[model samples]
Target: MEAVHEGEIVDVHALIMSFPASNTGFVVPLPSENQECFLSGLKLLFKQAGGIPLSIRIDNLTPAVKKVRGSEGEAQLTDEFMAFKNHYGFKVQVCNPRSGHEKGNVERKVGYVRYNFFSVPPVIKDFDDLTEQLYQKFLIDRKRMHYRKEAIIEDLWACEQKQLLKLPDNDYSVFKQTTIKFNKYNEFKLDQHLIHVPKAKNYSQLYCITFWNEFKVITNEGEVLLSDARPYMRKRRLIPWKDILKDWVYKPRVVGHSRYREYLPARVREYLLTPSLSLRKQRINEIITLLVQYDMKGINEQFYELISKNDEVVSNPYDVEWSQYDALQPIGGENHEGNH
Candidate 1:
């Protein structure tokens, strides 16, 4: 994590998967898997049942739609995706770009895939072997009755398909995928949002956002992966760093901006680096949450109060304050010694 300061590249990506009562996943693939094929498979599965959902809920995925700007009252839906939705007739809704609770269904799906399949997928060099491995996972492992739900995932999927929305007549090509470039300050523009990435990836192209629509930046060579949304820009808003500012508080000489520090109250700035690591970290995260909850000013004011009581701010008000005893004796020593 310290590499974030040394200007290392940070990548994050979001994964969306599906599971049934079998407690096993119907899909699992590497982050770099072919998105077109994956979406086609999903369309096929939904077709088998009936159609797509009346409304599809997803995290903010660029290929599907640009994030909806709540303040602006709408988002810029990509041209290709607009057509896809028009064809499918499934109204797509996004979770709060930052709120996981809004999309618990998909979150659980991701968990199941990671634990039950991908963690131990049978690997092979050939595509045929890979397909066979996937088939075993879907048919053999995923078909078994679940322990807790006591029902087969296959059965649940069948029912879900029966009620899903239908695919459209026209073919839809997936987004070729896009790259995120961080500015000199190690910040990248995610639509109207501004996100700070590690400086390492500056001017290099190794990051991309996935179709499933969550902020998980991933590197091309698989060296580092992290979770962060593309930031939005709201004028005069000082967003604090989210949960990660703990790393910054203890460093003696710091330079940079964070979601947590951006919105710090004018008064609180003086004390931001004073708190203990854990306490300061928690405070930083809380301020970020508060910034999301209220405006930056409101959150900063709260911060001003949060630390007001324990104002043990060790500022060197006088870097060269002389003790009274030293001040009185120091003048005589040089002169007396020289005379002797």
Candidate 2:
């Protein structure tokens, strides 16, 4: 599926599932067709359907099916997908290669959903928001009369629900676990994104647990170093500036080459880029301390005001009267004077 996401026309994956008996259909839009997305989509489908299907007729998608044996032989499933099936205790019914008629219902439902639900090429601001909207559309669609059956689609679906396998006590853990090494920047590359793991040593091995929407960097001792939302676009970098700024105070030279440098306010960036190494270190240290009490926006605004008033770079952190920035003060009325 192609949709306008954040004003960019990017390709998205749509998982379409349809029940032949009730003529009920489900469609889940995913960011990618990775194993995590495929498995997570199945989990979402099961949740929406209220129970797991006894047998799912599927095409030879790479996420699930690694290889199609032949026209009649059983398809080989990926290890993660095979484990997922075992956990849910469902049966797999792989459709034969080039045999579109075998699962014609879902194939047609895909076209129906593409035209009826996504005909306008939805302007998606948030992926989850789009998903919720589609789910509501499906619910409304179910209220209509079935194409072939006498009863409404929702009514037939209600009767078919009782025949489904009982939902398991616990949901399956859908994630892809792998070992990754942090680069010299204390960041690891996943897809085209550089995910920073603060405090992680450079060139160190760590466990990366990837989910459909987020990923976690784990230490060797199983300590979670960072758990952050994964970026959807390519060539993106996820940097926790506040956390990394603590480390940057010592390595002030590298601040110039930082990918996040341009993102900082102009005055703040100039303050950090000063030729005086000691001043840069002192300023960043103060900024880091201030960040503990206030957000980046507040800090940036205060710095902008201070620079505008002084008309010259504040040589020392102690020169500024921190109390004057009362509007940006932290809650609970904690005195910040002695902290400097």
Candidate 3:
């Protein structure tokens, strides 16, 4: 499926689950088709159904199936997927290679969902909000009569829910943990995205724990260093500007060559590029302190307004009083107090 994500038209991974006997269907759109997304979608499905299915028939998806054996369809499941299945205690039936007919119902439901629900691409500002909206739509859809059962789909699904296995005491944690080394810029490449780790030493190895939509970088001693929303697209970079301001203050010259320099507001960038080293450091230090109480956007707006009033730089950009200008006006109205 395609969605407008953060102002860009991007492909979303749509996982469709169907209960053939009841014609009950569920769909979850994900940012990517990685293993975490695959397993997390199943977890959400189980939650929505209020119980786990006894057996799940799956296609040869890369996240679940490492390889399909002979014509009989014996398969080697990925270790993470195998662990998830064991945790849930469900049987996995892998469909034969190129055999869409085996899971024909679900394959058809995929198209059904695409046309009925996502015919028009949705604007996804928040992924969780989008998922909740889709869940509500599915509930409304279940109120209709089944295609062939002559019963309400929701009622049939209610009966099927009673036969499902009781949910586990706890949900499975879906994450992939690996060790990665940070580059000279204190950033590590994950899924082709560069994620900056604040205060991390260059060339240091850290534990990277990847979830469906986010990841965390931790030290060997289990201290969490950074957590950020993971980007699905390649060549994207995530930087925590506020957290790194202290480090950057010492290396003011590097700001000019930074990849993120272009993203800064022109006025703020120009302020940072001042020729006086002492002034640049002082202003950035003030910004770092101001960030604790106000966001960069607010600070930038205030700074821009202050600098715009005068051609020269304001010594204290953040602490200017516009009311002072009104104090300089005449005590009485201009027409009554004096001649023009």
Candidate 4:
């Protein structure tokens, strides 16, 4: 599928699964026509349908067919796709080479979707939101009478749903795993897109799990350090400013000289370079560490609130009771660390 997204042309694969018996269709947008996308799309479709079909008829696409056998023989399914089929307990039926007519049910469904959903050239801000709207539209359309079945499509789907295989006890993780080394700038490139990893050491290896909608980087022990929504724009750099601050805290002086300093809120920049505050290395480190624990916006609010008090004497930024800051609270509750 081709569409304009965020002022750029995006080329993606459309996975359309059609149930001829009920005239029901499930559509999933994939990043590519690769093995991972093929499996992920199917997994998402099954999850939405709540069950697997007894058998799935697929086109002889490159992702699914490693080698096409004779018309009478079973086409060799790619190992990854084969494993997915086995996990879902579904029979695989492949169409003959150049024989799209065999999967006409889904082909027409794709056309219908393209006409109804993509015809207007959607202004997509979020890829997930677009897919969700498409799915809801599909459901609403199913309330109509079936073209030839002489019954409501949704009603017919109810009957077809009864014959589907039950969902497996465990859900599948749909991602393509890769290892990448960070550059001196703590940046890594994926599919020509640059991603900045804050506080990452140069030459350190990071594991990435690429999904259809997003990608994540994890430590060697599998703790997720960074995650970003996959960008359609080529060669785009995704930088998390919060993560960037993790590195800036080590060099307090550089924070003032960096080009991003101007981007910081005025209160945060002023507090960092407050003339009245001691710039001793230990004091700088303490302020940096504390600021990291609290968002600049929240800290700025506190700064203004305190500065407004005529009765209170505020000398140094560190003089504030940062531990009492609301934003510093841990996710579950407050931290029980020693007094600051």
Candidate 5:
């Protein structure tokens, strides 16, 4: 694990895997150490290697092993880990207790990966991007000749790849799927963070699949209704303000008394509370239309600045040049074409 030396001390855990025979290695960085992280790392390794190893050897980590009986005794593996092993058709071999020496190849890979990739303490903004780039860097190591065998690592891996087991046809989700009934507020709280469900299905039970960094709420029919990209180490509610405002456009009067009213921009709140209901509805509709091309905060901030400074409101809010407000919002992964 390495601490991301930015403002926050975010710890990024690297799951390192190496094939001793081929002298090939794979590393997958995750948010933290957990069952989900383990599963995601293994999935990434399988995708990169193009097949599953005959057997995976690792230290007795709690995520994989529930209990390590003894050198001669059977190792008790976690149910989830066992399921993963069964799906991939790989045998799980746990090193002896306190026997880091037993996994020498993987142990040496820790320093090799660190010195080559993590030594500079990668200046990265997105965890996914950092992991993806580092994986590509790892591929360069394959060009080097093996220390003992004196053969290129890439060529050896190519031969070893054919001997490995093929992946199962089924799609393996690295997250745990569960169901949750939406409360009266049309929302559900996971890990003390409240998330809004779709207004149409307020009271309906949805299938919630929780991942390491995010969660998804799907319909009973398997359609994804919402994808909540949760921020790490933050305990704040994530309400889809755009969705709520869209619904509020039909009933502008509710904008004043709704629980989420305070979250609206000051200018927008004033406009909605205007005594002229027709004008309020018109502006609300305009806001809903603006939501498609711009972020709510950017639109709200720019709108407030214009009305407050100029002492005049645009006759048609949508007609206003929105390009200036575009930069007010941060474009997060909007143009990301890189594959995960």
Candidate 6:
């Protein structure tokens, strides 16, 4: 019981169900069902049929539309229903209350199906599987006129699909929704630590952040996962080794005489907290080489001689301290290896 514009005939094959908009015809994909699945189904229909209706006329099922605005007693809809309408680009024009006249076209269509096609309800299988099967049944076979213009419902649907509204750009990662408040740092936390987001858009909108990849900050505005860690990660921020202390902590960090100065090369220490595995291993080896050289310097001048070759990196030749260490004559000359 739907209206097709002048010169258009009702496409009789849309899935049959008691419609919401105009009790007159079936909703191509059951709109009274789950919003996500229902919209997905409708989009498929256009992909096959070729366009969305300027509007869908229905009988106004409660599940489809909530309440009417202004006409409070008359009709109003829920937020979810409103989102559905906007998403599909449809104007839901409800037919008169209980007036079968509004649905004459689809009424005949549904009855026509029962009389001409299935005497019993289609057998239950997995719902998604069933939908796919039925779609194949109608879209492919019913559309073939056996090769004249080579036209079918699929071509018609492809035409309709081109006219459909664009879907949202970014996918919502199916997050559990939560209300979060920003901290004084002007950043939000999914658990501990900070992550960046559009500062202005905070608190006003809801967020959907993933716990594991805190970098993937999401919002209802259709944002894709982006790394905003740099702005929040300050360089050489002095941290009490105790604050991050744990099994991860080591004797190298016992406050004021921070072992970090001796343990890690300056560049490596700067980025070590969030380093790649290979980089961490490489830095560890570099630190171990320094420790070995420093220990050997105590036993023999050869170690000091070998280490002095790296003076451009480890020491300032212009610094007076290197000359003082050079002046130290051996106290007992046990002379472990070679020249002192």
lDDT of each: 0.47, 0.74, 0.74, 0.68, 0.71, 0.41
Error of 5 at 169 (Å): 2.6
Candidate 3 on 227-306: residue-level lDDT in tens?
Answer: 77787742222335576667768987777776445444434555677777777777677667767766555555575554
* lDDT, candidate 5, 1-340, per-residue tens: 4433221234578888899999899998877677877888889889888989999898999889988968578889999998888888898888888989999999999989888787644544567767787788978889999999979999998998898888889968778787786677877777666778767364356788878778888877888888866545342233466788778778877877875564454445555666777877777776776667655556655774544443345454443344653455333223221100
By summed lDDT, the worst window of 10 consecutive residues in model 1 runs over: 1-10
Clashing pairs in 5: none
Give lDDT tens digits, candidate 4, residues 313-335: 45433444445543664322213
Give all candidate RMSDs, comma-separated. 20.1, 13.9, 15.2, 14.4, 14.3, 24.8
> What lDDT score is found at residue 84 in candidate 1?
64
How do the residues 1-340 of candidate 2 rate in per-residue lDDT, one tens digit apiece?
6555322355567888899999998878888888999999998888888888999989989999998968566689999889999988899998888899999999899999988977655645456657777889999999999888789999999999888888889878888889887777887798687788777774257899999988888877888888877777431232355777987887988889874564454445656777878877877886777766665556665765544444445454444444554455542222321111
Ranking by lDDT: 2, 3, 5, 4, 1, 6
| Best by the TM-score measure | 3
Output the lDDT of residue 46, model 1. Answer: 49
- Candidate 3's error at 316, in angstroms? 37
Off by over 4 Å in 3: 5-10, 71-73, 202-204, 233-340
Candidate 3, clashing residue pairs?
none
Evaluate model 5: give its TM-score: 0.59
Candidate 3: global Cα-lDDT? 0.74
TM per candidate: 0.39, 0.64, 0.66, 0.59, 0.59, 0.34
TM-score of 1: 0.39
The TM-score of candidate 3 is 0.66
- Regions of model 1 farther than 4 Å from truth: 1-15, 19-25, 28-51, 126-132, 146-150, 168-170, 173-340
Residue 127: error of model 5 in Å?
A: 3.1
